[model samples]
Target: MVSRPHGGRLVRRVLPRDRLEDILRDSRGLHQLDVDDTIYRDLENIGYGVYSPLTGFLDSVELESVLLTMRLSNDLPWTIPIVLDIDEEARRSIGIGDTVLLRYGGQPVGLLMVEEVYRYDKRLYAEKVFKTTDPAHPGVARVMSMGDYLVGGSVEYIPMVRDGYEDYFLTPMETRVLFRERGWETVVAFQTRNVPHLGHEYVQKTALTFVDGLFINPVIGRKKRGDFRDEVILEAYKTLINRFYPRGSVVMSIVRYAMRYAGPREAIHHAVMRKNFGATHFIVGRDHAGVGNYYGRYEAQEIFSEFPDLGITPLFFREFFYCRGCGGMSNEKICPHDRDLRIYISGTRIRESLSRGVVPPGEMMRREVAETILSFENPFVE
Candidate 1:
């Protein structure tokens, strides 16, 4: 039995946290796709004050900014779920600032990881490492740190696709198979890339309002050039989770999937994958599967209506806009200033500020999250 932490109400449980921790630690070498904040907001319902610990120190204004960051990328699919085994003859390697592709049967299928590199204290850590960038390349990128030193840079990538590694890649349906086996009735999967922003906090809390348990799953794949490395992103999220979300309400995991800039369709693909991983419901939003306006505003939301046959549920939300009247999260309905209050932001604009070393507006992200995002280079422009 598995239990969830819901607003002072505790459910039944069979496996203890320590037991789960042990299982996770002992379980090594699994093929997976990684994700980030953008994917997280698109997958679940989250709200503020859900994680009380961090909320104590984080102001409501700051929290709203985080929510904006989460909403901005909410529609984009940041992960493609897969399963990897420990004993598999998986080839592994490491690098920085390069996108990886995972393919199957010579057709580009899905993403593995978006690579981002970070330098700190005389060492560079390839923080969030996961599997396959393109479906064509079923390789692995695992990050191992040695006492603050990053390791796993010299391993070779096994030709997963050509070498008959297809068996190792768990399709969405197969992921559902494993989730049912785990007995995790309700799984709340959280996504992110930059750091846990306030809007992100809202999205995760909002999701908990309806789910059984939460997975603060961030992407640790190859990233655009100049993006924050895995180590930095990892530390940022760990700090946010530790200081904020409930200990029992959330489980932190890394999705090894990469980003495909394909917003709406990709968003649908992500929800389906999460369903395969045992998620009963997934979050979707505006511009889902979009790249520079490649997708219509509601394309991602509209796409979900087509997937009822896939046996997955989607939580579609309008873009989380900041309203001056509400002084918090408000949509056009409640927000009288829809015309005046609506502010559209992009990773490009955020990166522009960061490349100049100026922290972006809290309206776009929490101060702390903004600090982290700004500290990194803008891989898109670079």
Candidate 2:
């Protein structure tokens, strides 16, 4: 059977449809705060049980504990803090024991029962979560741009944020049911924010050899510039799986959460999320969820050692590259090829080639996937 959700039970915080009207009517008297896209994604995860064991945004005490030790106040293995930041005016207007309607795109999506309103040190948060205080880092930049005050409270969802990919979005509960229906007792999840390359394919296929099902759960949230758009990613994966992967062996779904690029910590977060989705194993490859050189390439794989009973096994992989000596894609541990025989394609090279209207080599990405990527006019122009 698939593993239990992280921290035991799956949390379901969304109220029944019949009861939402009554809650909305009562919430009219409470303050309302419009959240940004990032905060909205966080709320969606919390309410949908993607971030189970977390009923709401973290209060100051929980936030501090997470930042300092990568654990929640309850000492569970939580890497990043789920916080709802607000401007000074909203902070002044809302206080402990008050209720606030959390809106996204000018629509009431949930209600936050306020528990704490506090200020945090952004630099400290950046350094603690991302191991950097430099604003050039996208994760750090996002941290620096956040509002000074954070509002913590349990959330009640009225309408979950779907972001136009509702058909591909599946909550943890839904995914577990799907796995059960497929008779997949052992499911391995592969997390991605980019279009699949040959290296990624290698990882997935490698995991498939051991598991009954492969779950491709891509992050469908706000990404940095030059990253593939959500639609492009979904379509590319569809093409990849339909043409290459065996039918009934793979499943694709969207996990709506902004990338934190917190490297090792983010890997933990990813594994925990997959565990919640009933995955018995998770793939942690080189620089998983990493952006730049801020983290060592293999740090994400190494981080899993810190959490012994994470309940989900981490399938660690080294950097995969085309080895001309072996005439196939191979990693350092298996291939004895020298540097001269190893062919590696960096994401920058692929992006540059795509921008120049050139398809990346089949060695790096499948020709079908590359053509799908090129179908868009400068797919990474954003």
Candidate 3:
């Protein structure tokens, strides 16, 4: 049986197709709020049901609840607050019950029916959500740098902007239909921001062995310095799938959402998002969605135990490395090799090698993927 969507139904907030033009025409008179790429991505996901059960940006009450309890006011589990933040100038121009035009890159994209406009304590928000006030952590830094005022309301978006990778961008509804058509009742989703390593391949393929299909959904959004570019990740996965994977068993899609890198909480967030996308299971590997040394290696996996009815199973995998004794890629639980014979290549090592125009060892990354990384001009320079 297919997995049920979280909250029992997919929350699609986009205006109906026939009413879109009329809505756009009526939105011209509304106050306009120019948003950044992150908000734009949030709006797109909200409209498309990727962030299901969320009709709009979080209100003050909901945001507070999420920060304190990782649950919305309705008691649904939602770790991160998807609030439409704005500067004081923008906040002052809008009021309760006002409709605001949401624009991106100077072009109108949507309209937000402002319900609540409130100021937030940035440091407190950062500390609560990310469990730290240290600006060095990327998630905390992002929260600190965001606008002080947040606008809360339902959104009516125009058709999302298709920026070159339209074919790879599939909404939750579309993915559901695709899976049904392909006769894949049980689908496992593997979320990643990095390019595929052998460990990733192992996790995905292993997950596929039990499920009817595998969805390799890469997050194609703003990434930190030295991380693989969106295009590189797409091309590398394409190469890996085309050359190695069984046909019709796997599908690759791009999820355009900014990474919060909130460690264990973010893992639950990811699983919930995939659950909305018709996934029966989600891969939660070592340090999934973690950054730096803030979280324990298996903390992401452990978080799954807190929410038993998440509507999706979290497939946990221990640290994967190539063992000369096993003579193949193996996890710590399966490989009985000593540390001396294990060839462990961290993402840091692979990135450094790629930055210096060297391909990572074949045992760590596929030759095709490594060669693709080498073909790019200064892959990590950005």
TM-score of every model versus the real structure = 0.50, 0.95, 0.95
Ranking, TM-score, top scorer first: 2, 3, 1
What is the Cα-based TM-score of model 1? 0.50
Local accuracy of candidate 2 as per-residue lDDT tens digits, 110-177: 88999888999998999989999988999899889999999888997666544688888889999999
Tell me the tens digit of each residue's lDDT in model 1 across 150-205: 11111112122232323333323344444556555777665566555455666677
- Model 1 stretches astray by more than 4 angstroms: 1-184, 342-346, 371-382
Query: Could you tally the backbone clashes for each prediction?
Result: 75, 0, 0
| lDDT ranking, best first | 2, 3, 1
lDDT for 352 (candidate 1) = 71
Q: Score residue 209 of candidate 2 by CA lDDT.
A: 97
* Stretches of model 2 off by over 4 angstroms after superposition: 25-27, 160-162
